[model samples]
Target: MTDTQAVQTPDNVAPVLVVDFGAQYAQLIARRVREARIYSEVIPHSATVDEIKAKNPAALILSGGPASVYAEDAPSIDPALMDLGVPVFGICYGYQCMAAALGGEVANTGGREFGRTPLRVTETDSVLLAGQPAEQPVWMSHNDAVQRAPEGFTVTASTEGAPVAAFENLERQMAGVQYHPEVIHTPHGQQVLTHFLYDIAGLEPTWTAANIAETLIDQVREQVGENGLAICGLSGGVDSAVAAALVQRAIGDRLTCVFVDHGLLRAGEREQVQNDFVAATGARLVTVDAAETFLTELKGVSDPETKRKIIGREFIRSFEGAVSEVLGDRAASGQKVDYLVQGTLYPDVVESGGGTGTANIKSHHNVGGLPEDLEFELVEPLRLLFKDEVRAVGRELGLPEEIVGRQPFPGPGLAIRIVGSVDAERLATLRKADLIAREELSSAGLDSTIWQCPVVLLADVRSVGVQGDGRTYGHPIVLRPVSSEDAMTADWTRVPYDVLEKISTRITNEVAEVNRVVLDVTSKPPGTIEWE
Candidate 1:
């Protein structure tokens, strides 16, 4: 799940609010909560207590951060959170914060406890660990430890290194754990989280994608009624495709998909969206060829953000034109198009800050790209789901594997992969290199191991190398093979040396105008998925 899904607040579902303490795992907590079939949201630690209370969350979770309680700028829990009358769960730094807020002591232990640690549950009778074994393995990554519990709190579990690993206050319905339960390294993490949600907080697990589709379809039927016509913006990508499929399922003949074939798309992308999407979903699709228009607008533009904005603007124009044509034709037949459907997922909404009305990371063409004077009401059926869940729902709806399981491609497509200005020559060069990398990776059975292997072309930079006993001056292609739980944050995957060698050798030998191949080892904090 990306940060978008991490903070998505599904309609009519009771939400669990996760207070962000600048922890990397803040989103993980939200993902876990959603995985438990409960909706959740995340807010920055700087958010005021009143702001948090206004969300009316079913429960509260404080995320762990890399901070010591004694530090000057450490994140602290809001006192108002305690009086909100909702169950609260704290992890790591959050655990320390809870202890300190309730008059406990937190000491900085010079010796750090990182990675997997055996946690022994001394009191398994507690609601959080009700049906669990006495001793279990839990993941721990912390430098500070809680020395004592606050008043009315009892130590429920502990490890050899930390004395107060787990503590609970039944009267306040509050609990804290030093170890992180959000990570997969913790064997029983999900079980403990489920216990807290169902056994302690009394929340029901009913947040399935099927239930969401059923509920949204009813709402769509009511809003659109019998005479309403809807136009869906279908990007060949999974999010948009899934959204279109769901909306079509909701309002069959009333829905029309507008797909813009920007020349920046990967090889065979346009055909897939044009032919495969219609064949799979049977939704009426309108294809707009804006390749020349996009290329014309992107001319002479080298800045990454500028290219993104230009592409977004041009895409909207093309889509609007298609919608107008479809609407005009329908109007001649006495039908009207009143709703514009977008496959805007929760990540796009949350990252764009659509949920809390805050400034988003950047303006997305689909989510934040709406015109002020637009007339159509918005219909986003897949807005409540994560990408993986969206794929599952698409499969459940009988979408083909090629359409449902396609890897994520950025909106800018190969334009972002080309280092400098995006032109036909540069895009072609990058496409060839990218295709070679993908083919080789798939041939070597490394496709599933790596989330995405972005093949980047350094158009402006050239290196001299010997090929066929002659010196050749050509640009190098960088292979960024990253492993991620969600696209929000990622780490470089450790591809086998033999596989890497094959990818390197093939890209240099087969793909012309390329001399060298390198790998990106950086993570998301340092580098985004796309290298611009």
Candidate 2:
């Protein structure tokens, strides 16, 4: 659920369009709609009427944004949206915009509602609030409130500060709520949204993982025909593994997976990909031991961006060599390779300037950091999916739990985990500390609670400590355990002190080079999950 909308439109399923108003709730709204078994898409608030009409949506949902309707640069809706003859639901900022666009009175109330507020249902017959509790708590975040309803709309619900908290126009098939219904903080929120989708818009629940998998497989086969050979880069993580598995299903033996060991991976990862993935899919696999090559190239490079670019460039070079070798044997038999497979997910696309109003944060090695003269066309099967959706597809394809449920690891691997220049010694030190943390967390059955614990090696920094009888200086390890729905935003996990003590003690005792361990208590805004 990155801000990215689905690029490939599902052919026959009815799509519900969720217009994003630069709100954080836009992705959450689309996800909620999907939870109801209905398909949804997100578009920017600046989308024109015709652009939205192009989606041929069954219903239109306006998402809440962090703008005031009366502000100079506030995002407003097109008046033509009201005449689209489709059911429309507006939340928060969308509500204010819709009200102002439909000739209703909206004023900037000095009393702004910031948190949970109670709503009193006045109209029981209203479609949005039908069969729900008369009094319910809803999440509210807005500065302006609707002062009066439009001519034909009825004010269905009210709060203490705002008389027009909710309103609906039955004849026009349009409604609005000043409070956010997409957040789980609002208890009957999903039900209200479901009512609008199924009961009002007449949309059916046809979006499923199984159907999506079949469709993607057909798409891949159509892209790479009967004779073309496709090669995938396996990183031993779920994203690439799942993408390769799907492509393998599409083209069978025509797909060759190339894995480059850059020496930045964690313990037991290489074996997992070489053994488990190959056995599960029964596809052709090629393993390249390029650890020394990567380390040599990254000898003095310390900047994160530079390291990522070098890794990406070297990866392409390594992959191209593998492809050429694989194709050389094929050329003797008159076959040519045409496609290079990548595991680029939707968030990678969005964060790299694909989404409507997003800025380029960092270059994902596989997507934005590829070299200019790449040889083959890309066959990215997981390009349009989120991580969870990719995992579901993995399960649907009968992949083992170890590969499917594996946590996300960066493409640059431990190179990004080390805050300084990477070397064999630093990698080994980080690996040992990382292994201890992972093993202890898993043993405590807290793996599910922590999204990912990036054990970072402060390779260039050293602190003084007393070992047996003398003073010793050693590097410190930073434990960054996070909890998140996606990698976009994350909060530090609150692991029990006993568990943390175990991880700290084990790493300090087992790994000689590591003396102290510190916890990263910062969230995503101030710091990323990975140090580098």
- The best candidate in terms of TM-score: 2
Clashing pairs in 1: 4-347, 352-360
Shift of residue 425 alpha carbon in model 1, Å: 0.1
Best by lDDT: 2
Per-model TM-score versus the true fold: 0.88, 0.92
Model 2 residue 217 lDDT score: 90
Give per-residue lDDT, candidate 2, residue 284: 79
* Per-residue C-alpha lDDT of model 2 across residues 311-352, encoded as one tens digit per residue: 989998998888767775677887778898888886777556
lDDT of 1 at 265: 79
Model 1 spans > 4 angstroms off: 1-8, 46-55, 66-75, 107-120, 129-138, 141-143, 159-161, 219-227, 332-338, 350-365, 368-377, 445-448, 494-499
lDDT of 1: 0.79
**Stretches of candidate 2 above 4 Å error?**
1-6, 523-527
Q: What is the lDDT of residue 131 in candidate 1?
A: 71
Worst 10 residues of 2 by lDDT: 1-10
What lDDT does each candidate get?
Answer: 0.79, 0.84
TM-score of 2: 0.92
